[model samples]
Target: MTTDAETAVFEEHRPVLMGVAYRMLGRVADAEDVVQEAWLRWSAADRAGVREPPAYLVRITTRLAIDRLRQVKARGEAYVGPWLPEPYATDFGDTVPDTEERAVLADSVSLAVLVVLESLSPLERAVFVLREAFGYPYAEIATMLDRGEPAVRQLAGRARRHVDERRPRYDVDPAQRRDLTERFLAAAAEGDLAGLMDLLAPDVRLVGDSGGKAQAPLRILESADNVGRFLVAVGGKSVPDMSFRFLELNGGPAVLVLSGGMPDSVFQVDVSAGRISSVYVLRNPDKLRSLASA
Candidate 1:
């Protein structure tokens, strides 16, 4: 292939590569870095020997992400509070028309799932991302990881079991989630404690990630009462100039609060049985910086 042809091939698969990397690492910056490294490697590779471009690119991105994830884990950076994945803008556009496939993608990247994935071994995470999120065959995954097919299968099984055991169940219907999310934001913004309580599940859990750079609960808040009151109290203390914009993020509707035209925080809810079962707040300034530019 000529230079333009090679570039076109890389660009065509960029989204899939990004999706794989992001799912593997759970941080946008790190995922992008991994993808860039994959591009460099791809561009320098002997293209004539590469018959399957998509698989080759995915393998490169996944390995790079595994390396990045290992480095991040080694850093031992203490999280200020509940650590949530950096909110990613997920717009499937016209490419993903299948409902079930989209749901799989969304659930795989949800905050709760990503948090659970953080506990997985790097190889396990890579297997899960490839087999679960992207539906790669065990043979293909084994080749990508340079491991035996049986070992890859085992890794996939273990990762799937772990994720299935920990990932919270939520309704996947976008319309239902959007409706509840809108009501959720309205209730919190108005300081309507009763309204907020009504929307929360009895055992609803709230996890706020602030990284100690902003005001947020330093511990997880559980139960409808506790989460509701905390939200109302925080709302009461919020400055008058705060504003919120509703947008689809991480495959669902989310509230983006802007303070003076800058991203201040993000609020997203997980609805189960038509009530909010979990609420995630991202207040870490480092995490919000990316959204500010969006």
Candidate 2:
């Protein structure tokens, strides 16, 4: 038997759990499933003797997410192409009510960071998310993972170092990112190679996710010239007229444009020293399904 207060507590913690699962899994659908399962476990629990519902629910969600990550890892080995995180069509305001908060949230959720996260082992990823993203104390995190405090700290430190090395530093000013994105989009859409080069950094890399449903570079393309040429070649073809809608992505400005009346793709811009350092174009139709549904 449950009291009204207990039910309310569970509901209050749902978003936090969803956020945790989303960061851990890098896919909204999978995160939702994990959270749903957490709810089921919570509801089935004997509430009378239980205390600290928030921590209890978080433990359930974290464990379920780790198990799911193991399964996802095996699945990725046989995936069709370069795996990309699923995109969500969440309202920026709803997710991050504060303007400053939106930028931080967007940068954190960036596809590049999520991709880097994929490289981490399951425990490493969990430790990083719980500590870095959610600000969980090491003692609490250690208990959640059933590990000693020292071991948990080491795991989080290792994950942080790995991420710091691979992940580009992000600037989260929405207006600035939005402006840069616009310039990049306009340059690409018009097939202006020079303009594109001007906006792209010297070491710019372009990662495309087509999932074999559309044409994309099978591997990551390095160098500004190569990325520019590829963009020109692709843009020359007849592409659906897309409306560029800037949205908060991975704690930064991202474009979620609609083509043919569906969510076509997401573009993540990595800006460094006022130039776009990298551009990630996710065109995998399957990955875009959630964004479409949103």
Candidate that scores best on TM-score = 1
55-107 in candidate 2: lDDT tens per residue? 88898999999999999887865655577777644445575576655554555
Where is model 2 more than 4 Å wrong at Cα? 1-5, 89-104
Task: Count clashing residue pairs per candidate.
Answer: 0, 8
Clashing pairs in 1: none
What are the runs in model 1 whose C-alpha is more than 4 Å off?
A: none
Model 2 gets an lDDT of 0.81
- For candidate 1, the 10 contiguous residues with the lowest summed lDDT are 235-244
The positional error of residue 200 in candidate 2, measured at the CA in angstroms, is 0.5
Best by lDDT: 1
